[model samples]
Target: MMALQHRYPLALAIAASLLSGPVLAQSAIEHHVWQDKRKFEPYSRTAESITGAIRLSGNNQFATPGSKMTITFGNGKKAQLTSVGASWRQWDDVDGKKVTAEVFKVAKDPGTLLNGNTLCGKAAKYLVFHESLSFGASLLGVAVFEGSKEPKDINSPGLCGTFNYSVD
Candidate 1:
């Protein structure tokens, strides 16, 4: 009986490893679709036109390469995607009007934020503009779940907050 128990765990482990392949493959395909600009459906020109870092509500510094963000798709689906560093001009006075502005290139196409296959859902259809102006240094958006019936809106607290930004 003892020997059987030990072998059962090993068998289960092997089976799990084998089963993970297709899941991983699907993740890869989803990520590829996210990266392909041609696959994106138009959401908002005003939101897409804005250029700035996507600092999560509590984050102090802007999202640089390797920063992580969590995205929730309805139906109990969630994903965490990493930011990849992209070049943009440093913060400068907007129109030299005393207001400063900087560009986070990834915000131009939120899919560029996917670094690996952590985004596992029914595939994101639109990167919807969610909110802005929290912590004075952040912008929030959502990857609308494909086929979802829920309205696109700022539904997650993780995406927006009024507390002071924290550096971690």
Candidate 2:
């Protein structure tokens, strides 16, 4: 009985090591690769556009995940989108001679303040936005997502840098 007790631990440890060896080896061989554009869907451009960015950590480096923004301009007259925030803010400038203006919440993502997948629950945890804009009958805008926007009811995101995507 004494000999069996000593051998049992050693035998179990050996079995465990053998069972886990392939899994551990496979994990060591797996790594992430970077690409300028996703082959599944090369960034696209149209009269409408979408854009934004968020950090995606892989290996030792962090990269911006992918996001697409579409725009509608020229004949486009109105803009509207849903917001994750409880309210939306809009600013109106009455020229350099303005004295005062209206201040209120629109209750949604008015004028495209982080809408669509940025707030949707069914999308990736990170958002990386890319925009392609043109002048004639084309769209132009920037999109950015901050992990801070994530629900506080859950544990806060631990990323150390601000996530952003801008268009110029």
TM of each candidate vs. truth: 0.23, 0.20
Q: In every candidate, how many clashes are there?
A: 0, 16
Q: Indicate the TM-score of model 1.
A: 0.23
Error of 2 at 137 (Å): 30
Cα displacement (angstroms), candidate 2, residue 168, comes to 28
Q: What is the C-alpha lDDT of each candidate?
A: 0.30, 0.27
- Pairs in clash, predicted candidate 1: none
Please give, for residues 1-168, the per-residue lDDT of candidate 1 as tens digits. Answer: 678768698887788899998888876521111222121222233223321122332222333545544433212233354443322222111111221211121222233222232222334332322222334543332333333232223232122211111111
Q: Using lDDT as the measure, which candidate wins?
A: 1
Q: Could you give candidate 2's per-residue lDDT for residues 1-168 as a string of tens digits?
A: 677768698887788899999988887632222112221121233112332331212222112212222222222222221222211121111112211111111122213323232232322232222222234322112222334453221122422112112222
